[model samples]
Target chain A: MTNTMTTRRKSNLTRGQLPKYTPWVVVAAAVVLAAAIMTLVGFSAFGWGVLAAILFTVGLTGISAAVEGARQAKDKLATCLVFGSFLIALLPLISVIWTVLVNGIPGLTFDFLFYSMNGVTGQFDDAAAAGEAPVVGGVYHAIVGTLLMTLWATLISVPVGLLAAVYLVEYSEGGRLAKAITFFVDVMTGIPSIVAGLFAVAFFAVVFGPGTKTGIVAAVALSVLMIPVVVRSTEEMLRIVPNELREASYALGVRKWRTITKVVIPTAISGIASGVTLAIARVVGETAPILVTAGFATSINFNVFSGWMASLPTFIYTQIITPTSPSNPDPSAQRAWAAALLLIILVMLLNLAARLIARFFAPKTGR
Target chain B: MSKQTSRAGDRIFSTTALMAGVLILVVLFSVAVFLLIQALPAFFADPSEITGGEGFWSYIWPIIVGTVIAAAIALILATPVALGVALFISHYAPRRLSQGLGYVIDLLAAIPSVIYGVWGITFLAVQLEPMYEWLAEYAGWIPIFAGPASATGKTMLTAGIVLAVMILPIITSISREIFLQTPKLHEEAALALGATRWEMIRMTVIPFGRPGVISAVMLGLGRALGETMAVALVLSTGPLILSLIQTGNSTIAAEIALNYPEAYGLRLAELIAAGLLLFIITLAVNMVARWVITRNKDFSGANA
Candidate 1:
């Protein structure tokens, strides 16, 4: 019987099975065939890639169906498509970063970081574009304005957001008022940034006369966007504080307020801090609200309550929309790209910091 | 601590918290009321005084159509790819690579809108202009791709593409979370029945994740509807037209952003009214999305 089995043409285990290297071989063959086909027509990188992908998919599916079964073929097709989708989605991200880096690095000079656009005029940009001078002016004023406005926004949003979250998780007990607050907060999250800008404009226009565009106005608009995020995240963090800790505090004769302030908040502080940082990151990049609320200023302004401000987002917007030198837009474009790079860096750093804080500061679960 | 002191502290603390909660409600209420008050002038303004020289409805109608068309384009383009990406992350990707992929997508979301706008006008539009020309040449019979492609590559179609890229991460992340929430037992059961991976996912995961995917798409729709900077910077605004390849069709958010800086008197109010319309539209979309999410919360395992 063993001799007969050994002499058999095929084993049961190996029947209808493709080798593990089948896909790689198929892909390699697809690439060669795709290239030959493309050469016969017009060879373009995009066309070659698309053709290779198509050939690979069809070839693999056909081979699998012939060797294995339709089910395995279908599974292979789905896997290919799913993986293809991921690669396609990644195209824009990779392109965006590549474009930014290539275009932004040249313009991101020391002068670009330090000098304000206060005295810099079209002449300067024109001269720079003509290679008569280095690219003049910088994002200093815009950076200062962004920092000041964001600081004020954080100051306004955090206390209110934290307290509201505390109320939702600790005091509301899912009551009618709490439900209403929770619902509205969710609604607030959906408010368009432009609409938030309009709200600030309308609110301040009614109070402080017709036209009041200042850093504070922009800060208020940002807080409108920032508050809901803070409330939602803080509320989640506070809710997960493990009821035992609060109960223990209560058992120790600590008051509700004291228990929350001492035990609950301390436990969830990491999450709350990270949430706040993310909120800041979110609002820092907002353009529409700042554009409408703070208007635009070429010069640096320190006063959030009074003068107009130029944020990094609006700076990039205005530079692109209405370049400093319409006659020679290269320098303006360069500056705009550099500012964009800076803004992206700021946002990325904040995101990284938030993640690091969340990972490192998580409370130990050990008893 | 003394009982009276403790009582005072508790009263103060709880009341302060309650007041903060109430303040949020008040702020939200005021946003609507204040916008309404500002927009009332446009509603009552003379018919000929509005932008279209006809009526407020006529003035706003084209932009509304433009906004809806842009958002629809974004939603249509992003939904399938986003679902694929979500499935790739939650199911197809190797275990160790999934979390890193999630972060990469989140990074896409982290980039500011203005940078997207800049990239759109400078890079994406330039890259797509040739394709738009090719489409206009070959597909001119299709009304949407009709001839006379944009010279600057700044058209509604281009803006829509940029918007698609912008909203992709939102849809992907939300859908990824929901897809990951599919019950392992159901997946295993489907597999145990000799089903393939695709069949298992189709039978178990897709059904469970349908509501989540819908809500995710809706949220992305809301975002695309209100996205301002990208459309404003990318689209070369003109009156509404059927041909998306043309340099026409302006969205509400883009219109408001471009005009608000120089606007005064009735123009400002008109823009504010436009903003009100945008606010209402997004609000409705988001509310429905949230309602869908909350309704499915019990069985979705999303919250868990």
Candidate 2:
């Protein structure tokens, strides 16, 4: 009886007085212990983190189990699991950020940033031997191509997607054709980007000539990929433009077209802009379709209508896969990483701007 | 006169809208037709003349197998972790933390696939060597882990792991959305019945989200099947599934990306044929995903 009683947890009155920050203290101790062990064993940094995480989990649960009792232990375990799972989910994301920054920074210099590699030798990277490293090149042409192609894609996709969305919400009235269109669009949403590229190639192959490659073709490919997303998002935005507003427009004796153009569109324009921006961000990193359609070029091709264009994605792809300097591909790898960083930055900035646009332009709700 | 103008304006806008909607169908149909037209020669060609020997079947079949196996690996690895994260966000995390975590996860989707490839090749493949070796040593009897771990770490297994990381976010976000939408009354009722927190979740949330979870996985599978660069960058070439631990193989879409640059004539045609297969597979998977979502709309616990 005495042994069992001694093993029992303390009463609430006594335990309540215990330090509330005890768990954090345990965590700090776990981290230090984990670090000491990792250093002694010569483990990697990742291993140290994993060890610390495990120690924290085990330590907290044990501490809670001993002091606070079983129910509290279970709760603490659940909490630890949640935090641990989140950390695990975040690991690769952290890896991505770290790798891009670490490997990408060394590749960014003035010449690498500014000059187009139009006249640069491709078969042999002579500049590499001269130690004028990074292959004496810049992604200027690729940057121009990416912007030019994406602009064309946005141009081609936005109006069509917007109108299609407006029609679905405003005029479909739940018709079968509308239903079918919605269903097909959902399916189209899953078509591989590479497949879209193939479609463009086949389209141009028959229409213009076999093996035709150009930025316009790539733009069309991107447009194919972007339309479904745009339609889906725009449709959601347009649907939410309160029926009361449409009724009010109708009550004012306005035509359907005019009401849609002025009231409905004006109300949803912000969300629409955000959606379009997101669609652009999504397709701008595409390499497969561009690889198939636009093809890679070392020099900048100003015209989208003819000639192969060098987009950032395809540029990175070629640089990584088949470095121009066979003797030392380190410069090429550096360039690829740099291009990747630029692409990530562009996408991230676009996302931020889209969120800002959505927030800034949102209609104020009456409190 | 004003009425006539208004009516004519309505007609024009409606027609334009109809045309735009119909254009989506046109594009979908034309992609199928285009792929078919381009691939017909490859399908009809003499088996003896195909690239990589043993005829077209040898070249194409292995790729299809590799794709399925890789996606299977991704699905297996990602599903549980994604579910845990989703559940953590939906049920466990503080409300503020859950929202922030969700936003962070969605950013995973925004990071470009090519960037994923870069990371996969430059970091993940190298970092996972110890794990592969460990598995090889301990689980040698298991066919998948039987042979020696490749020094390069460019095997299909590694590619799948990269893909697992790539697809985790989408699955997490979708299932998290579904789990979050569980009927609140059901949850309260379960709790009121003296069920443990996990029990309440198991009974209420997981049941409600089962269909959504399946659909989310299917969507992830769709993404994994079509992912190009990550697979291309992480994998070496050739079919190595029989050896399981062998360092080379390719998915159909990855093949397209890797081969498209230098491809001409039959090579390009064969690649397009592969793309066609990928298109059909994703299309079917997506159709089923839509069907699953729409079919259970009433049962999905949404009030509306």
Candidate 3:
């Protein structure tokens, strides 16, 4: 009987069956003990010490019990870590949105939306003394400049990036030239945004005389930053087009270029559009590049080829860095905050529009 | 058939298409070369005109080191957080909850870097000061945490942290997609063999997702390394300090942004050369990431 009993105990250990509640018990004990220690150390603000103690005890008990009875301890730890990270990530995001919304709202009213910094003197004095009331200056010029510059950048990047993708996907068949292009595009994708800004500034400085700061140069700099993104994204989308589709078009006597234009692109148009939109959004709010290349301006200028032009990003940067009204800095900060909010809203709108376009234009599949 | 005319047409069409593509590539290439030459005009100029009295090696080396160190720290801090978030979205959370969380994360990605900069300055500075102070006070033994603290928050640590936040969403989204693509058969086998959920994730899921995660991290690293506006806003450009927590160091991009406007002649050229160095760094990062993705060792079955 003694020999049989010893063998049975050995078998049980080998089978990996243990008490389910073992881990949970330990966990609970540790938590309760930690809470006790915290309480001893005088950390009872908002009953946090007590709460931590309780949670610790409960979690430990649950984990031990789970191991003893259910063998589910593995998932419990992962769940804890995941939730912890989620909350940690949420902290800055929530803080940023809340802070911007709260601080920026006072200056986001109608008049503040329409006016410019033109002729505005001191922050508090200007707002109060302006023929209108408080929060008088708007981001109208900045808004226009941002739109015009971004539009020009889009024009320059899309054709080049798209055509390059086309050559890689439809034409090259993985030839030497295609490989070279691929390598270079990858390299180009990593080009520093500030370097792109520096390039634009230097190029124009040489061509149009030194200290030549114009909105067009800024647009070109933005294009340099944008093209790589467009190429990579577009290339991926094009690559996903079914080879069977291309073959089917070839079988139908459609010329290669014509087939690509009519079939492959149409099928990928939704993705291409979404990708382009994302690339635009990526570079739209670049402040440093703009500051370096385009410089900042208070009044709006429509022409991209000449003079200083205001953009929402530079506008926000200048307002915060050098408050218009030093005496009453609060109003200037308020305007800066408002501009930030507007920029965020603009990005969100672009995202939403892209999603809608994607859904609407996505190729229909029959039921 | 008019063979001569047809040949001429073919030649013209091919040449034109080739020229267009070649021109695009050339323009891109010139951007890099032109900046280098522009930045190094001191090489072309009289030695007397070089500003800052420093030799070529002295000036460029510190900035390169600063950029690399900050980017590495940012990647290290961000990787685990990104993986955790990715796992949460792909496997741990309920479907609807995960969807909502994912949307919020993407929105974070969409918010521009400048906004991050402004927020970093006004809010993060005040909020995170205590932590910075605590480090400086206690960990002063460590060179990085040891420093004369600035009243306004601008440091390598702060820049790294801001970069961490900036790249978190991107890394999480990509990693999540890769994790979700782990072969169901492999996971089910692990589960059926008495592996717990977390065990299944660790052994089967993580192994499958490794390459994808690596590429995502590389991409994030690339962005963090080359990031401009965010760094410019958060950092106080100065000579290199041994400690990361000490305020006053400059990354290559921040250096270019800060000094590009005032620099002239050879000084301007030197800045451009600095830009060329930055370009090379980014290019290496991008190429490595691309290679990682193409290896097909990770996340290959996910798309299927």
Error of 2 at B230 (Å): 0.8
- Say which docking band candidate 2 falls in: medium
Candidates sorted on lDDT, descending: 1, 2, 3
Any runs in candidate 1 off by more than 4 Å, and if so which? Answer: A1-9, A12-14, B301-304
TM-score of 2: 0.93
When 2 and 3 are scored with DockQ, the better candidate is 2
Off by over 4 Å in 2: A1-22, A25-29, A59-76, A122-135, A364-367
lDDT of 1 by residue, A162-192 (tens): 9999999999999999988887788788788
**Candidate 1 residue pairs that clash:** none
With a 3 Å backbone cut-off (N, CA, C), the pairs that clash in candidate 2 are: none
| Model 3 chain B: worst 10 consecutive residues (lDDT sum) | B9-18
Model 3 lDDT per residue over A1-367, tens place: 6876778845654444455555566556766666677778766543553465456545753644554444554465566667667767787798889888988877788777777788777844566645356556889888988999899999988987887787778777889888778767766766777878888887887687778787888899998888878888888989998898889988986656666778888989998998899888888887777887788788878898888888899888788767887666667788889999999988888888777877898877554
* Candidate rank order under DockQ: 1, 2, 3
When sorted by TM-score, best at the front, the candidate numbers are 1, 2, 3
How accurate locally, in lDDT, is each candidate?
Answer: 0.93, 0.87, 0.79
Which candidate number would show the highest TM-score if scored against the true structure? Answer: 1
**Mind giving the per-residue lDDT tens digits that candidate 2 earns over A3-89?**
656755564345533267887898899889999999899977878889988999999888877876776677677778867878788
TM-score of chain A, model 2?
Answer: 0.89
